[model samples]
Target: MIEIKDLHKSYKMGSNELHVLKGINFNVAEGELVAIMGSSGSGKSTLLNILGMLDEADAGSYTLDGIPIKNLNEKIAARYRNKFLGFIFQSFNLIGYKSALDNVAMPLYYQGVKRAERTEKAMHYLEKVGLANWSDHLPNELSGGQKQRVAIARALASEPKVLLADEPTGALDTKTSYEVMDLIQGINDEGKTILIVTHERDIANMTKRIVNLKDGIIIDDSKVEQVKASANV
Candidate 1:
């Protein structure tokens, strides 16, 4: 469902350039749960950003479900991003004042979904994430895991083709992190392509495959003997 070839990315710092990704190449198929593992400066986040269309690559190619993702105007890129990619961040980027239900509904509202339909869809996703009872709670009112669950619901509310999670379980405790991974594994079982960017070895083992990155290149790529997060939980 996703493909990249010879991807290269760099950032200029005054007279010097910091090369983030160099000759990266990989592919992800539908319903596959994959984790991109790397250390802090290994370029995992840069690769994820490019995959999510949040940033452009300096060279090479990226194809999301067969569409070339290069040189598109901002409007079209935004449209494609909204239509195909769903993002989950470590910071749980929810509005402080909004309730969980409303937060989940925000993306649909932006899509011009009517009030009734969006509310129904949002509630469905919230319930799917086991947060229906917490709908009226605000971010600050919920625990870290709860807030992350709300974020996951919000990401899924868009019904996008790919789910890109950046350090999704980074802030939660071990049990909570395993629980969240269980939820993500369940989602992948239902045929949605999921890509998680995490440095934790145990967390990466929860995914079906692990792609190790070092110095901006994929050092190892292989399917793993999936470890059940539910067992750990």
Candidate 2:
């Protein structure tokens, strides 16, 4: 569903340049749950940003769901991003003043989904994440897990083809993280393609494949026997 070849990225810092990704080639198939694991400064975040189309690569080719992603104008990029990608972040990125339902509905709102239909779709996703009863609660009122669940629901509400989660369980306790991974695993079982950028080995093990990044390059990429996060939860 996704393919990238000979990708390279760099950032300039005054007179020096930091090369973040070096000739990276990667692919993710439909309905696959994959984890990109790396330590600090390992370029995983850069890779994720490129994959999400939040940032353009300095050089390389990226194709998503058969569409080549290159030199997209901002307007067209935003349109494709909304149509094909859903993002979950470590921070849970919810508006403080918005209720859970409103937070989940925000993406759809921007997509020009009508009020009633967006509300209905958001509520369905909230319930899918087991947060229907907490729809009216504010982010501050919910636990960290609940807030992340709301974020996941918000991501899902877009019904995008690919789900990109960066450090999805990074801010939660062990049990809570496992529970969230369990929810994520369940979602993948239903045919959604998901990619997780994580630094935690255990978190990566929960996925079907692990892509290890070091020194701005993939050192290992292999499928493994999946570890069910629910067992740990």
Local accuracy by lDDT, each model: 0.94, 0.95
Q: Each candidate: RMSD to true structure?
A: 0.8, 0.7
Q: Write the per-residue lDDT of candidate 1 for residues 45-116, one digit (tens) a residue.
A: 899989988899999999999999999888898889888988898899999999999999998987889999
Clashing pairs in 2: none
Over 111-152, each residue of candidate 2 has an lDDT whose tens digit, in order, gives 999999999999999999999999999999999999999999
Which pairs clash inside model 1? none
Kindly provide the TM-score of model 2 when superposed on the true structure, using C-alpha atoms.
Answer: 0.98
Off by over 4 Å in 2: none
What's the TM-score of every candidate structure? 0.98, 0.98
Residue 133 Cα positional deviation in candidate 2, in Å, after optimal superposition: 0.7
